[model samples]
Target: MYRGRLAYRPRSETANKIREVNKMKEGIHPNYYQAKVVCNCGNEFVTGSTKKDIHVEVCSKCHSFYTGQQKAAAARGRIDKFNRKYGIQ
Candidate 1:
């Protein structure tokens, strides 16, 4: 027994004709402009987006995963309680 190779399915003539008739009208879609991303660590880069500008808290420059510096983020009250209960230094 031999397995048959997969074949490409050509588009139907009616589908092609319908696509030609139903062409998209221009000037209706939203404008896509360049957006600037600013990170807290002073990293900035330009990218394409629907919005004109974007602000972010973290980026490749300051992210712990990228920088290899992990800092524990704990609330003030939670840190105090945990330290007091566990007597952690």
Candidate 2:
């Protein structure tokens, strides 16, 4: 990023258009978009609902609730509604 007098003066109309295009690219698809967050200490890694792998550092198996271990980990309100609707135990 150029700053102060070092910034591109854009003397020509073409130069201005080029600068604008560059700005738009920076505005979208930023650098961090490619980096999926891996859980730091073997907890869980999730990219929205798209991906889950267990037992590895970011796996679903190691996550406390995902494997359904800690008692009835699911929230009671949602579970009751689901059971009532689907006749699930």
Q: Pick the candidate with the highest lDDT.
A: 1
Give the TM-scores of the predictions, in the order they appear.
0.54, 0.24
lDDT of 2: 0.58
Q: In candidate 1, how many Å is residue 12 off?
A: 8.5
* lDDT score for residue 49 of model 1: 92
User: lDDT per residue, candidate 1, 5-89, as tens digits?
Assistant: 8889999999999999899878998889999998888889999998998999999998877776563443556788999999997
Relative to the unseen true structure, what is the Cα RMSD of model 1? 5.9
C-alpha positional error of residue 46 in candidate 1 after TM-score superposition, expressed in Å? 0.5
Per-residue CA lDDT of candidate 2, range 3-87, in tens? 6565665499988888888764545553433234456464434443333432345455556767676556557777899999999
Please give the lDDT score at residue 82 for candidate 1: 91
